[model samples]
Target: MAQAPDHAPDHSGEALVIQKVQPFGEGQIVLTTPSLDADGRLEDRHSAYHENRSPPLVWTPVEHVAAYAIVVEDPDAPREHPFVHWLIWNIPGEATSLPEGLPNEASLGLIGGATQGVNGAGKIGWFGPRPPPGHGLHRYHFQIFALAERLTFGPNVPLETLVSALKGDTLAEGLLVATYEAPESQ
Candidate 1:
């Protein structure tokens, strides 16, 4: 029952990812997934209104990384900034693939006691895409941060806090962008 910092985090994923999220020099991990369709569209099974499950994800291993963090965001939401679908952290450095349908809870034992952060929905773990119906297509940016050291932070850490902790510890970062379009209204 730990609380995050006293302030709120910037909800703009673009701002966070591009400007604020700084990893070591020109470093990028090749993030990939087999869950998306040929057109790089996410499956309905991962939709918030549907199965609401997490898609399987895999990334190329980075050298000398002690941990990894991932943040899934939709910069196309009707709101002013990006909408966070998943806020997860504390992945073991040896993990190269995340199994599909990870339970929505803090502290995952399957991944060596990895912890989860809060999503835009104010919940722990992954909250699959639920863009408004007929809102065109939304781009989900699944960003990953490779940390040089294992971090230990207070509970309920916001995305900002995690990003802050990654400042100098980030060895590299990468992304796998996926698209989703809600079905039009009946």
Candidate 2:
């Protein structure tokens, strides 16, 4: 079997280090899904072949943060920039964990006034890995930003706008990486 490489890059300067607390502990964020293996390869179940649900995530927030945001992207996608898979913001600073199977809706009532934004595919909510066949492995980065203030944007905001709004306002951030490749025959 081909082993998945450690595709997670070093975010030394500006990126904040996330402290994972569940599923796995105190390292890269653990994406708990029977659909993926220890090395972050996505199984058929978590891909387009089956139910494409968001993976459960848990982490510790930095002190004094007023709000949090999450952005999941595929940096290896064949595009000019990384392909966004999920974008959510306005997570209450008090929240330390996100439950599995988050609903594919605009407003997440259960997550402390959190809202979903459009992904790279121009859709809302979590879009699971669906890399083209024979494209080798793709790294999916799940990044969380700790902001010093609550954002004013509404749901379905564009990725660029959200990113721009975060500038100079981020207190800290964390990252978790996962990898996936499409079946050769698919």
Candidate 3:
């Protein structure tokens, strides 16, 4: 996962989680988000320090794929590994984008039966960035992994389990990179 693309260079820090996971099979889906500013900085509302909302994401749609998973992590956090901000999976392969403001629930029945896993905060669904105050900036890697089949597990999956399950099973991946920083005065 640490295989840097030609797109983004500065990843805050080389997150341990990113350093572990292997790159997907082959090919890549173009991941894009409108929630970020032109400079690729995450918006205030999409932050845990503010509105704490999940950002909307769009990607290049594919055919014959089983499903897709979205994993968002902050590599710059002072942690053992990258801090996971969101863990959502089972998105229908036919889908090309996710709508904004997804509710913080385990099973997302609204969006093609997608289920959310526990985030780094131990909360279900998307946990917006809350990098430490005066921590400078943290790059959040919004990675979408294309699976060859649906995961065998049920709702509320754990991070480690997901990582283990996806080991070399990713058919492809799409990434959207954005950065966030807590206000120094906050």
Candidate 4:
């Protein structure tokens, strides 16, 4: 029988890299879904539901990170991701990812022991895009942060509470944005 190739193929078309650095602050770093441009401006779609709901996050890697945290949000919706669609933390230091459909409770191994913060609706999990009809595509941002240590946001801390806990302690941050239009609108 023929022996298999010793080295695996390189399927990674374009590897992820640290493009630049930004101060780890509320206004310094930001995340946005596919609906917006690099400038953080809104895009067309005429419905927040088309917002894809998953925001693209971008941030600098911490110099000495013991752990990391991620928070996906949608600020324009008068709500938290409008108000915390997803909250995940305690990621390891070697990790540099927050792929799509992640922190998803339905999907196994996405967030084994990570904390899930409460959303605007008072739920303790992810809440996908449900933007109102004709309400232009709202921006959703998936914010990732490099922390100095592993955190315990408690059993069900809201986004604000978690943010408060992270005060004066962020080391690095990033974001990944994705856009989605509702079926009828699409």
Best by TM-score: 1
lDDT of each: 0.82, 0.70, 0.81, 0.52
Residues 73-146 of candidate 3 have per-residue lDDT tens digits of 88877764578899888898889999999999988889888988888898888899998887687889898888
* lDDT for each residue of candidate 1 in 152-181, tens digit (9 for 90 to 100): 864387667777887878889888899988
Clashing pairs in 3: none
lDDT accuracy of residue 134 in candidate 1: 67
Q: What is the lDDT of residue 40 in candidate 4?
A: 54
Each model's RMSD to truth, in Å? 6.4, 8.7, 6.6, 17.7
> Model 3 — which ten-residue stretch has the worst lDDT?
9-18
Q: For residues 106-179, what per-residue lDDT tens digits would candidate 4 score against the true structure?
A: 22255445565565556655666555555555545566776677776564655455665565457666666544
Backbone Cα, N, C clashes tallied per candidate = 0, 0, 0, 25
- Model 2 Cα lDDT, one tens digit per residue, 110-177: 99888888877787788888887777788777888777788888766666677767765576666777
Query: How does model 3 fare in lDDT?
Result: 0.81
Q: Lowest summed lDDT over 10 consecutive residues: which window, candidate 2?
A: 16-25
The TM-score, computed over Cα atoms with residue i paired to residue i, of candidate 2 is 0.77
TM-score of 4: 0.59
Query: By summed lDDT, which 10 consecutive residues of candidate 1 come out lowest?
Result: 7-16
Q: Model 2: C-alpha RMSD to truth?
A: 8.7
Q: Which stretches of candidate 1 lie over 4 Å from their true place?
A: 1-14
Please say which candidate is ahead in lDDT: 3 or 4: 3
